[model samples]
Target: MLDQTRRGMAAFGLALMSGLAPVSAMAEDRPVIAAAADLKFALTEIAAAFAAETGTKVDLAFGSTGNFATQIREGAPYQMYMAADESYVAWLAAAGLTRDEGTLYAQGRIVMMVPHGSRLAADGSLETLRAALAAGNISHFAIANPEHAPYGRRAMEALRHQGIWEALGPFLVLGENVSQAAQFATSGDAEGGIIAYSLALSEQVSRLGSYQLIPADWHAPLNQRMVLLKSAGPVAEAFYVYIGTPAAREIMKKYGFGLPGE
Candidate 1:
């Protein structure tokens, strides 16, 4: 009976110790990330894989880079910021909102997408776009709000470059963010959309549609940049470092993102 009593006491003590450990010390701590909307699909997969490998959790907030910048400037408590354009990250860095210098992570490309079985032309060039609009084959076209979304701005630039901006003006539908624009297209409310190539390659999208890559020169390069915030913890720093690993790079590539030179 005494031996059994001792064993019970030992088990109780172990349990107590386990329960007393600091929550922060029990697992790899996660950081709060403010990310651009175009990175939705890829970032979600990347974040999940990162947590599985390192036992860290990632709290992600997705929106337009401009909106994120405003939130960060207003003290949103983010430990890192990933912007669709380098300008926003640079601006935040210049304002001393970040720790280390900003790093260019990826270059995003634009694309035109339509529902999988839609009768729209597959070429998706400027001429085909105009022809489709004239034929009334497409009623509405969605785009991220150019006021905030870099992708939206690029889409506008592409339209203007093709000299069809005014002609398509009446049919343009604006979404609050790039992801929302994609939702508009995917839901069939809009016949098609201008969205990020990364999002275009997502399984959810693949099952619903086909996409055509827009010419690279249609607008300025969509240079994505990531910055470590001044309030970032050690774990956040480690996660940032992990983003540069070959494994992460491979994952990025699978989602249609290209590295600096590629």
Candidate 2:
């Protein structure tokens, strides 16, 4: 559906370009922003910084990128969206749901993680996992639901690259989103799981398990993209800008996200 709501979007961008605050912040005190679950920790820190620096609150909802895209298509009231996979944003832009195709804010990586007491090792090469599986020592392996989660899709690709996807099905534990997948990966419920490197790097997750970075060539790059929806306002627009700032980029790097330029 053509987004008739996008008619005045140019004005918002122009105002931003002119170094002026958008004309209105809208009646909503907080703009709802949808983000991919891989950003759970990093984006939270950035949002906290955003509020402290600008004194404006932005509500964030994190989940699978594909699920959010479906909601956005059905007119969900998200003012901005940050997707784990850029293709989702591109699809929305083509449907006229976005102010534009948006920004490639970050690139994500995956890691295989095992809880503290697991028999499996967090091996990037996945040789340990292959050996453990062959020895019948594997119980459950976790990942996000590939049907709707970008991290899960990448995990599938990586597993396939190693010639294990078909055999691992019976032991697979799928989470609805990558963050939950991370939770499952480290919660002692499974042997180990492939999950977002950003989540694996966080203090909360690192304390629970050990992780090793999967080779980037194993799957497609997680080219994250962010976009403003038709209903975006002053605060939402400002928050969008804040994401690309040096301060925000620094915070993202702290959590292992690859910045756009460096």
Candidate 3:
């Protein structure tokens, strides 16, 4: 009798494996979101909380906003785009690529960062940076590529505002994006760099160096925005709206972003 029972169970298992038996439905799909490099830390945390609440997953790809915008225009298969600048969303909207005008999510800030123990004083002022550069103590000052990275543009603006853009030209090391610029600063590849305040507050970056916030008036506002692409699915749409919720805003705030309307 036991041998017969074993044979019966084996037959049932074989039938299931061979697709001869009814099976449960496949799991729901996760939407892909293309986001700016400056959103790396904050969005990751927000996505996790979103997943925990909704039981849906969101896959994020972080890079320079301009690159992502170009890729979106080229049909990169991303369901949504979150940019460090609102202009990118407006451009996408004008191209008829987005479902709507999009939403402003957060405002970001930039900072000057140097590896811990560097000669540059952490005085939280550009004059300190100017003095270090004049002393020849900073061999390379890194920043995101201003051509495609908003942070880099702001970095350049700040330097120009401080009257150091011309002098720092010879010592600049440009990264592909803000995150890479932070990496350059942390790795000591560049003696100092301008990067997102959010990244500077991240534990990974905080351990490697210290930063001083750049005056907001030095550059254009970093009004971050997000949009659902024309091809966005239900998950993407839900997540897009979720970002405006209080929970999501709080997480962004924790990461150093100024919540919209605050």
Candidate 4:
């Protein structure tokens, strides 16, 4: 009877083991976050860190704040929205799309980038660019589309402030968003372009090009903001809070973002 009971217990243990799902097999349902193009790298690093520490996952979709605002307004399924500017977050909040007024995450900066080995100086000043254009050496330049991208609008402001908006108009190659603008400049598709400083600091861009910081006074401040959408689940809410942690702030700082309230 003792041997029989032992066998039965062993069989039951095996059955239990067979029925249990492996932790690796069970995928965590990562919450979807719509983040600004400027955060393509910074937020990605932050999200990966959040997952490593908390064992929770997050899905990030990077794009223009204006495009994202429209999608959220039209009922896109994202649980969180991080904009390049606070105004978009406020717009969503006013539309009753967010849990509350969103929190400022960081301030972004712009830089002018040229592909590696370009004849034009990589100096942050626009003098080389103007000379190149006037000399007909540079045929194209890129910027995000000002209509729906905050960075693009800022680029426009910078160009206008420098009194070169109209002169450079014919050579402008507008990108869908800032990341693409960076790509264009890095790939030499456009001679060079103004893009987010965060991107300029990224490994990929760093490897392919050099950038000079566009003076903050050249354009409006890029006060980035993030909000938990009304449709956000627990995972999204938790990640939203995690974004405020020191770990996240450090990652942003590493990528050239100015910490909020700093």
The numbered model that scores best in lDDT is 2
TM-scores across all candidates?
A: 0.86, 0.90, 0.88, 0.87
RMSD list, candidates in order: 15.4, 9.7, 15.7, 16.7
lDDT of 4 by residue, 146-201 (tens): 88999999988988888878888877777777887777777755578899999889
Mind giving the per-residue lDDT tens digits that candidate 1 earns over 1-262? 0011111111101000111112242444567889988888777777777776665667888889999998989998889888998999988888888986688889999888876555564455767778887787766777888888899999999988899777777777777778777776655655777888988887766666788898989899999999999888866676677677777777889988888766
Q: Using TM-score, give the best candidate's number.
A: 2
Selected candidate, larger lDDT, 1 vs 3: 3
lDDT for 38 (candidate 4): 87
Candidate number that wins on lDDT, 1 or 4: 4
Candidate 4 TM-score, true structure as reference: 0.87
Per-candidate total of colliding backbone pairs: 0, 0, 0, 0
Q: What lDDT tens digits, residue by residue, belong to model 2 across residues 1-262? A: 1111111111111000113243333545799899999898888888888877766778989999999999999999999999999999999999999999899999999999998999999999999999998999987888888889999999999999999887787788887888877777787867989999998888878888899999999999999999999999888888899898888899899989998878
In candidate 4 the C-alpha lDDT for residue 183 amounts to: 73
| Order by TM-score, highest first | 2, 3, 4, 1
For residue 260, model 4's alpha carbon misses the true position, in angstroms, by 1.7
lDDT, candidate 2, at 166: 78
Better of 2 and 3 by TM-score: 2
lDDT of 3 by residue, 155-197 (tens): 9999899898888887777778888778776665566778999
Candidate 1 local lDDT, residue 79: 92
lDDT of each: 0.76, 0.86, 0.80, 0.80
